[model samples]
Target chain A: MADHKTKASAKTSSPSGGEEAYVPPALANLIGYYLRIAQEASFQAIRQGTGKSDLKPGWYTLLTILSENPGVTPTELSKLCGRDRSTLTSTLNGLDARGLIARRRKAGDQRSYGVKLTAAGEAMLRKLQVIARAHDERLDAIVGKDKPLLMTLLRRIVDELGNGYPPPPARGLGKTSRTR
Target chain B: MADHKTKASAKTSSPSGGEEAYVPPALANLIGYYLRIAQEASFQAIRQGTGKSDLKPGWYTLLTILSENPGVTPTELSKLCGRDRSTLTSTLNGLDARGLIARRRKAGDQRSYGVKLTAAGEAMLRKLQVIARAHDERLDAIVGKDKPLLMTLLRRIVDELGNGYPPPPARGLGKTSRTR
Candidate 1:
């Protein structure tokens, strides 16, 4: 896809006789368009920064959540991560296999399990934290002073649009809630 | 996954004796985290609104680009949609198979093909426009008067962070450009 910027000019004439930077008016102003594009860009940067590592993108969040909420069950991890249960289960399995997480039977319920980071998991997370922090620093530089406001706006979207529609709250038992 | 919110509480003790809405302090403040969640929420909303439709999410963007820039080649469409060439090729094949788009050789370039929507594609896009409009309306209600500001923040992320890292401009021939 490296040829995207130049080869795209095949069908159109630019004022400079080169690539014409055009986005249709229809898409130019859409918030969703920007949201998707921005997220994609941000995500790509994270992957590039982390490179090949023990923790994948979503895994870092999951492990971080576990670090704060140790013994958190698979279900709670799912909501905290916003990933479905099956997906979370598979992810946990991967972590377990790698000795990054440990799953034990819940205190009162043999059928249910409590998931927590193992020593290895904590070690891995600590390493990833440095990478994550650097990633955040770059984001901070990009948004600069607007960082806080941008976060509020993004949170507002999640609060409104996230709950506004649904598969009706997704495999969960309570109203979707996120403590700030 | 419907059990996500409820089942997730199994391992954690909540003040309410139910699902704990706690997020790790580490992730709670990161812009990348929110961006991913917000985008996922918005993307899910779009899919739910559009329901079962001929055009998929990204496909709508591609078709819209094609509608405005008819005769666009695969390379240009890839950049406009921010998709790589191979992904765009398969998507184009699907659209072509559905009789929604047509691809023909460029006037002077036999090596490349220009893609345009057929009457069906146009009709489908028009139908999607209604759904897209409704989606935007909900977003409007969510963001309200701050919509423009939110857009600026998002675009800044895309512009700065998007090019800040690199796969080195994707398979493009020239510098990345987009007309406002």
Candidate 2:
């Protein structure tokens, strides 16, 4: 077993006149490293701009989904978010406890519940959307006018990752179609 | 305050029956989301492939850095990784304890120490790199032939995000010197 407590000492004199050393660039460009840093920065900004008491990004996603769909079920929310059903359940529970959302049993199915935002939840989501928009703008500003291009490229990458292929062109308005 | 505990309960539901709820297309397209899912999948695979005891991604990075530049410093490592200096301190302590790296005082600098990987560290890095290559191949297979294009697009996004300009043209050839 690797020793869990050994500290690798320096091989040369410290640049700072003390013993603090640095790592190299080999690790810098790794995709995971970049993602972690970007995510952390975004999350920190969101937490600070909005009160920490509000919905986190995951929770906010659920709220946004419900708002758009009106009465989405928990299972649907799970699939949409790519979260396990178990994780969505707990996240929903937190939202319900905070009065940000409510889950009521569907008309016929005792096991299925329809989720929607409460008054407080709606207010919170509205406020959060404002913060999110501002944060996104800041992020866009950081990337400058190339934001659209960046978004397109990212979307292409994501689309490639999933099984779905890009859609074919819409039906018949071309010269051949008119002849037909 | 949000009930953190209740959030845990939401995770227990079954996910089989809900309609395909709408995910905000815009959110789905964000680079952050794809980067996150990809990283999560990679890390999970690493953990599973390595069993419970092999060095994880961060540790592998540290070792790689040490092997590449034998006398780097902890503060430099933290900066390169975008991790907090304090966090690097703890992680370095763990690596040092494991006898995979060594920390030695610089000849002239009293306050900074240089870091290097031990022979054990080199061997471990080689092993992990093999695993990582396999892992990356799996990911590429998951994404299909678009993997290269996806990586290229992601690299472009990072370049645009970290620096507000389009990437410079390939090395050694000025714009005027190139044949169109």
CA RMSD per model (angstroms): 7.5, 14.9
Task: Give each prediction's DockQ, rounded to 2 decimals.
Answer: 0.36, 0.07
Docking class of 1: acceptable
> Which window of 10 residues has the lowest lDDT sum in candidate 2 chain B?
B10-19
Give the alpha carbon lDDT tens digit for every residue of B8-113 in model 2: 2222122221223234754564445444454444455455557566567667766776677678777665544444456777777777787778899988989989
lDDT of 1 by residue, A1-62 (tens): 34323554332221211222345689878888778877877777777766676568767877
- Residue-level lDDT tens digits of model 1 in B1-180: 343244444332212112323457888799988888778777877877666665587677777889999988887676666455777777788999999999998889889989999999998888778778888788888888888888888877777765535434334443334522
Q: TM-score of each candidate?
A: 0.79, 0.61
Evaluated at residue A151, the lDDT of candidate 1 is 88
Worst-scoring 10-residue span by lDDT in model 1 chain B: B11-20
